[model samples]
Target: MAFENPSREKIKELLQQSDTVAVVGLSDNPLRTSHSVSQAMQQKGYRIIPVNPNATEILGEKSYPSLRDIPEPIDIVNVFRRSEFTPAIAEEAVAVKAKALWFQLGVYNEEAAAIAARAGLQVIMDRCIKVEDSILIPSGKTKK
Candidate 1:
């Protein structure tokens, strides 16, 4: 069975209010999907904090090896890992009391979504932050 994400209204609210988003699995390579999406959010004015054990920095923000290491309050936890890894990440997101957990396209995790939901964290799975940001990009700034 499929899991449901927050409604459109909830997503709009979350995006409007989220300021600091921790991007788990963000890669140093700009060519990677995670890097590109994080850049999109950056352009939208959301601070992107990279969380990769191998990365010292990404998108100019200091990178942490784990969610628990991030000292600042995290509004959103965007994951770019495989489905098998999402449950653990979801647990960490819940533990940190994050406002939401987002799993990028191709990384859907029903169980993980349920876990996040149970923890009272908004969950979005199998979606791209970049595409969502594109819709938000104002007319002049966004290309057709």
Candidate 2:
């Protein structure tokens, strides 16, 4: 079956409730989409955790080599890697008990989404978290 993104309302709820996002494949370069998007989200009050093996720091936060390396609780696992690489990340996200698994635009995997969903995690694919935040969350209040 094809992968579908969660509803806008659900997205808004996730964004509003999520405080910390672990950005996988985040880059140190400002030109990268992950860097810019993560920065924008950080400005909006969501803590951004950079998960990049090659970078020690990004957007003023300490970067970990992988998702499992992060010691703090992660509300969202936002992935910037290609679709082919997301399943492993999804597995790790499930193992880490992330609340949601988000695949950036152009990165979509049905199997990964299924794995996370079965594990009780909300799944978002082929979407940009920053864009969704602006559209779905206007008041910054999460629905209870």
Please give each candidate's TM-score. Answer: 0.91, 0.94
lDDT of candidate model 1 versus the reference: 0.86
Tens digits of per-residue lDDT, candidate 2, 111-137, equal 899889999999999899999998776
Model 1 RMSD in angstroms:
3.6
Model 1: which ten-residue window has the lowest total lDDT?
135-144
Query: What is model 2's C-alpha RMSD?
Result: 2.0
The runs of at least 3 residues in candidate 1 whose Cα sits more than 4 Å from the true structure, single-residue gaps closed, are: 136-144
Q: Candidate 2 — worst ten consecutive residues by lDDT sum? A: 135-144
lDDT of 1 by residue, 42-144 (tens): 8777889999999888888999999999998999999999999999999999999999999999999888998899999999888887776566544313221
Estimate the TM-score for candidate 1: 0.91
